[model samples]
Target: MKAVSLVPSLTEAVAVTLPGVLAGATDWCTHPADLDVTRIGGTKNPKLDRILALAPDLVIANEEENRAADLDALRAAGCEVLVTEVRSVPQAFAELARVLAACGAPGRPRWLAQAEAAWAALPEPPARRTAVVPVWRRPWMVLGRDTFAGDVLARLGIDHVHAGHLERYPRVPLDELRAAAPDLVVLPDEPYRFTAEDGPEAFPALPCALVSGRHLTWYGPSLAEAPRVLGEALRAARR
Candidate 1:
């Protein structure tokens, strides 16, 4: 079964689990480091021509990372596109299972089981702490309610100060975010590339955690290690 995966995490999931099934993937699908598939394009603006040229039997995409018009175009062109909606851990697992099964993956993949176990092993967080997590700068957008990353942080005992906002990814003024009096600032290294010197200075009064964006934001094979990896980073920077 030939497949074209637009989401990086799902690309890895399909490539690593099914092997030889992916005929094309987005440029951002960097996992399986040695992956040698046709480069279709980016997640938001995929090269529809190239994807169609690949003649993929299935195309995997995400509701959040991809554009609706593009998926509509693919469907209009008579291509079967699998659109995944992953907003939480359990939902991610279910979506993965559904996609894999739909694509004829041989039984349950080992990584899927490992990922489930990784999160299940974590004991309930003792006491939750309020945090401001900025995903981008220049305009300053944050993770709000119903985000997968927010739930991951919640599992690690960190609550979002912007969870009540109207937008899932809201752009708040920097001053207003600081005024919220968050206990810490959790910075991920992607979607904005926040580093120690650059991000920590914004909140001199609060402890800052520099986390891996893949572990904190992505939903796939990384789930197997995200819990331990993100938890350690949060704990190390706890004030």
Candidate 2:
């Protein structure tokens, strides 16, 4: 079954689970490092013409990562689109299974089962800490209510300061974020490429945990090691 994945996590999942099924993918689908598919474009702005030319039997996407108009256009052109919504860890697992099944996998991939076992094996965190997670800077947008990242953090015993915010990703002023006085500031290295030299400076008073965006945000094979990888980064920042 030929498939085109617009989401990076989905692309990796498909590539790893059912090799050579991907006919096209967005430029940002960088996992597997050796993926050789038609580079459609970015997740937000995929090249519809290029994707259409591939004539994939299935196109994988996410409700949050993909634009509605683009999905609509693909459907208008008779392409079957499998859009997934993963707001929590449980939802991510379920969606991954569904997407793989739709791609004609005989059964759940070993990686998916391993990822589930990894999360299930994690012990409850001893204590909870309040944190502010920034996905982007410049305008300073943060993870707010009902985000997959927020859910992931919660499982790691980190409570988002903006969990009660009305918007999912609110653009709060830097001053306001500082004023919130969170116990820690978590920065992932994507969507904005936050680094030790870059993001930590903004939260000089608070410990900033610079983390891998793939482990912190992406919901595929990375989920298997996210608990361990993110826990180490958070612990290091506290120390």
Candidate 3:
């Protein structure tokens, strides 16, 4: 099976879920190596002919990433397409399981049970909130309530100050950020790179830290490392 990924998260998801589910049964490939992603947004200027030529039995797309028109064409060509919309960590896991099941992988409940056990072992919440996590900029966005990032922060005992008010990945105003007054502002390296110098210029009054976007945001197998890293950040903020 050939998988065409326009987005990085989808790419990562396919990488983690497909092999385990397929049980290495199908040889798979992806296009646009080093697909210059500026933010969480997916592929631009995809090489369609290459993907079409692969003649995949299954084409997985994200409801947020893939173009509806493009998916339609693939379906019309007789490929079975499964589009997943992963808004939170649970949804991501469920979608992964769904894809795995569709690939004819057996014993999904066992895998999910193991994953749940790992998730259950993470840190508890703190008495106080610490930081705000912004995954994207330009329009100035944040990982808001109930998102993968929010869940990570919650696990780390760090409060997402805007969790109650904002939607997932919302474009928050600079003034609102100032008003929220988090102890530290976290700038992520992936999706968008935000530096300390950039922080002073963007919000002169706030302290900032450059964090690993992948660790804090990725919801798949990569999540194993997130709690430890985020726990460290939580400890640092307290110091």
Best by lDDT: 2
Q: Show the colliding residue pairs in model 1.
A: none
Q: In candidate 3, which residue ranges exceed 4 Å CA deviation?
A: 16-45, 108-115, 164-167, 200-204
After superposition, which runs of candidate 1 have C-alpha atoms over 4 Å from their true positions?
none
Candidate 3's residue-wise lDDT over 113-186, tens digit each?
55566677764564756677777767778877666677666666667777775576789877778788788777
Candidate no. 1 TM-score: 0.98
For each candidate in turn, the TM-score is 0.98, 0.98, 0.74
What digit string (tens of lDDT, one per residue) describes model 1 on residues 96-188?
A: 998898778867799999999988889988788999999999999899989999999998999999988889999999899899989889999
After superposing all C-alphas onto the true structure, candidate 3 shows an RMSD in angstroms of 5.4
- For model 1 the local lDDT of residue 159 reads 96
* Global Cα lDDT for candidate 1: 0.92
- Model 3 reaches what TM-score against the true structure? 0.74
Q: For model 1, state the Cα shift of residue 153 in Å.
A: 0.7
lDDT tens readout by residue for model 2, 1-239: 99999999999999999998999999999999999999999999999999999999999999999999999999999999999999999999999999999999999888899899988887888888999999998889999999999999999999999999999999999999999999899999998999888988988899899899999899998988899999999888783
